[model samples]
Target: MRKTIALLAAAVMATPAAAQPTPGVRMPPEIGAAYGRLGKAMMAHDAAGVRSVWAEDFVVNSPNNEVLGREQVIAVMEQDFLDYKGFRKHITYVGQKPEVTVIMGYDTMVPIKGPGAGKQVMRPFTDVWAKRSQGWQLIARQATIAEAR
Candidate 1:
């Protein structure tokens, strides 16, 4: 019994605390899947794919301090200004309501274009999504650079 207890404790200690889901924060599988598609679209720079995930009036308060519309963001992606070789979103908070769902997370990426090129950067982000006629679409976002290496 002692050996079994010690092994269990060791396993728990070895686990990353941040990897644990936040209490009372449950994300619907549909929203999680949509986020996955968005990441893939962004990485591929597929304008149509991106549009599918973003609402027509989608806007973002960019880290550059500019409020950009969906078209503007697409333009940036086309220009390779937002190109990234690696991207990971670490969702820490999730709030779901009848009309909308809000998620707060940090994204770590290695940019291959624009500022901080060829370096790993961590940005804290908030994404607001709504269930539209088609499906869940991102309506707003705010991303801020927290660290760069």
Candidate 2:
């Protein structure tokens, strides 16, 4: 509940357009490396590997304005990998701390060949990952429809 409250406040406060990372600026090694691990895990459909990246009190303020908890978002993650031909992240900024990092980026999905191919997309995401004793665990996230460049 504490985490949820804090996350809600974060969502209300953040102005991501003003916060966009400059193009070509790299993310921190800690964040890029950790996200790389999670990316590989997703491609492999390893539920446990994916779960390891989430904090116990994870929360997401979704594009539709709905709030989701850890279990719910994990289920969504699993389903997304299963449903899409490929889903990938391109990180733009990674704000770091000894124990916390806020990662902001875009995500692309390549749908399985069909009427759906190249027909759908979701992008521009922000995720807050906290380094715990076990490792980097995602604590918060927000994502929205991709905007044309």
Highest lDDT model number:
1
Give me the displacement of residue 15 in model 2, in angstroms.
23
Query: Native-vs-model 2 lDDT?
Result: 0.58
Q: Where does candidate 2 clash, by residue pair?
A: none
Model 1, residue 71: distance off in Å is 0.7
**Candidate 1 local accuracy as lDDT?**
0.66
Model 1 scores worst on lDDT over the 10 consecutive residues at 8-17
Q: What TM-score number comes out for model 1? A: 0.80
Which regions of candidate 2 fall more than 4 Å away from where they truly are? 1-24, 77-82, 113-117, 120-122, 147-149
Worst 10 residues of 2 by lDDT: 9-18
- What TM-score, over all chains together, does every model reach? 0.80, 0.67
Q: State the lDDT of candidate 1 residue by residue for 33-148, as single tens digits.
A: 77777766766677898899889998887654567688867765665454555566677898898879998877676766455667787777788899999989899888777777
Backbone clashes in candidate 2 total: 0
